[model samples]
Target: MNRLSLVAVAAAVFALPALPAAAQSNEITIGISISTTGPAAALGVPERNALDFVPKEIAGVPLKVIVLDDGGDPTNATTNARRFVTESKADVILGSSTTPPTIAVSNVASEAGIPHLALAPFPLTPERAKWSVVLPQPVPIMGKVIYEHMKAHNVKTVGYIGYSDSYGDLWFNDFKKQAEPMALTLVDEERFARPDTSVAGQVLKLVAANPDAVLVGASGTAAALPQTSLRDRGYKGLIYQTHGAASMDFIRIAGPAAEGVIMASGPVMNPEGQADSALTKKPGLALDTAYEAKYGPNTRSQFAGHSYDAFEVLKRVIPVALKTAKPGTPEFREAIRQAFMSEHEIAATQGVYNWTEKDRSGLDDRSRILLTVKNGKYVPAM
Candidate 1:
């Protein structure tokens, strides 16, 4: 009787499927699809660094990061998004620096019910606002910021130069919209492609239009062309650049030509500037310092700050979702979405990210800090 009973019990135990591991033991997988190469890599690299650092500070359950290079290509962004959702089984996704890839991946992620942390500058219109949220200031608001600065400087008519892409188009259109309300006129509108060495012809058009100021909108090193082209064409009007163009790379590329160019930017008033800024709060400072220490001085550019915030949002949300639900559970994915939308106060060196449903853009207009080039260096505007 004892042998028979023991044999029967062992058989039953072996036949039963093992209970699924508890949330604590289960590892959280977060997908990071970013431009580790291509033009935006300057900012993307810093973003990757922030993602690498998050788990180290937050001590709890195990975390796994599955990184995919978007190659700064929109099609690749969509492909990587699919892989993250289906192959990597990522609970949440974070990244993409411009509108095209961010928008592309957003469609895939939203369709799959996976929440996305959009790091790009483009604002989430009502149409695309359902599933994704951006960590940086929105694209539309930059135009208003630039206008206010332009107005303050007694500038009325402005020239515009932007990349011939969705990212630039959005910013350009928004700038135009904001300019109209302020009684500012767009004297000329110009476009260029990525990796283009010069915009001399475009600059000539802007010059002939007789604008009181010039506005440059684009990501990466392309921002330099406006400054160089403007100078080469012998235009003397003040140059106003979008915040996204406020990069150290732009300064390096334009050199002396960049001088006197004013760019709308988030506050860089020491660490205090981050208090109200979405992308510049506590972790932002930590990231900037760490990057500088590792990559030498000037490692943390303006774009780097926004990218870091994107990674931070991912780090904070994934673990919380994983702890509450299993990997494949819908609740896990929904939690990540709520984490970004409902987040009231995110601490970063850039500023506090008060993300909300109505405003997916984390940055507030109050945090807009104006920066200008002086002596081949970025300095606070007077």
Candidate 2:
């Protein structure tokens, strides 16, 4: 009787229907690598702040976020991406606040077949296209906006000072393409590293060129170095920056030098008083309202808005992915990749995302606005 009863109990236990995969695997891991500690901290800190708004769960699936600081280092970002895939078992990766680090992590994500959404602007290439998407408007689109403004102001010659990195190169190339179309000649081009304490030498050269305007193509607080130097030297032509510098850190660091400076930015920077028909106005205002409520009055950064949009992309795609596979599995990761590729007309804080297999940025002219630093705040340049 004991043997028969024991055998029957064991059989019954084994025969019970296995728990549904979703119930068994109810958590999704998202890995975030940002430059919270280093040169890009001004940009990364706000991005980290925006994560507070990401819901802990979606479609009853618990979300586990693991954030690592890459310190704006490409090597560190690569290591973080690998660790997230191999150790944290992250289904997707987001981060590395600036372009170079984001690009670095993209390689790791592609190798691991994990979907990556970068908050920084990225030039989508064929190799990385399989696994990556970015939140910020592409360089060319934002470049055109700046050049159009320059033409309106009757600026025909420009000088450039940019970071000695891919971010700077991309901006310069894109801006050059636009500048040529508008008959603007770039009189001088100079470069500086992010950690450089001074761009005075480069600024001197740029000012000596006596161009009608100057464009600083660096990001985060570093971009302020050139602007401050230019102002201190009393070179008062026009000064422009890339959208990469659209953070409060740039304003605070540049101080009075930042005033009257013009740049291109996502509409989220100044949502109020926007035309009702503006595509980004409604979503931008919503994000601004939520962000300011949490961080206090007027603390929203366009950099932070990019991170918010990354979450919005996840919100739209992850649910669809869950239908096919459970998280923490290769299939789930691939599902996310496919979902991101096929997404269309998704409105977020920055702009409407309409992605396709070939276009990872999913943003257009509607995504950008021209802004000027006025009274320690960003105002519409139009």
Candidate 3:
């Protein structure tokens, strides 16, 4: 009786389909803190929408995504990050859609020894490099694209109007560095809060200065405010924006005022113009197809691509992490973090990522392209 019973039990166990260790743990949790309610809402909304495209199950392991709204505030982002690490026990954290909030969450992820994939353009400081990587291209790489455009257009003097926040400061600093080398003078600098209803005062000051062109260092629909004000105040000059405002919402909010506005953005925004063999081409088209299919025809945004790329990075790393360690464990988190650090030539919707110990934001000049708003659509400028 004992021998037959043992044999039956062993046979039954062997007959059952083998489940992955991740299946036993139930799911892999990914914590996201994006700015869905404040100035960055235009950017965050699409990012939230793109998460729907992330596969629910990867290699037989279900994924659980926990998203929080930070309202574009750094303090709120920090709190959300702490909650994600302590309460959610997230294996990885992705978000806080803008620079300041992303930086705040990066601090928390580093402290908690978890991997963070920021959807914003992070500066990649040595401290944050330990556990953080960014989806958006860094400022200098994209700024050079804008700088060259300005040079071609004979923009001798430029005015600056940006949010009174880290995002603004970062872009302004990068522009300054690039502008100097190109012999472009920055005539005026004005700061405005994201929620400010009146950039009129700043616009007046900028117009009075009479610069050859103006670059607005703001993001999402909020970036439109200054441009609208400038147009209303009759400032007939070239308008340039950063990659942050590369969304349909910006155009809808800015209306005709956004027309002719130029921005440095990823090639995904203009997929047809991309070379077939380019690293970004295939992934960019895939994201564009998936996003437009769900959202609508021609509704893709670089912000959404940023979120999709975050998921792609996870998709590439988690399987490798699982090979070495189980989910919901410290070893697994470390493996994921190390995977990002060791990644090489990984294609994403934005660009090819080749992360390293020094460069967490693994993008170069190839990640950027000049785009212009024409006929209410983004067309490749170069």
Tens digits of per-residue lDDT, candidate 1, 8-61, equal: 000011111222332432555667677878877765666665554454323354
- Model 1 compared with the native: what TM-score? 0.86
Model 2, residue 18: displacement in angstroms? 28
Which structure is stronger by lDDT: 1 or 3?
Answer: 3
* TM-scores for every predicted model: 0.86, 0.91, 0.91
User: Candidate 2 — which pairs collide?
Assistant: none
lDDT of the candidates, in the order given: 0.68, 0.83, 0.83
Worst 10 residues of 2 by lDDT: 1-10
> Stretches of candidate 2 above 4 Å error?
1-24, 277-279
Which whole-number lDDT from 0 to 100 does residue 284 have in model 3? 84
Question: After best superposition, candidate 2 residue 57: deviation in angstroms?
Answer: 1.1
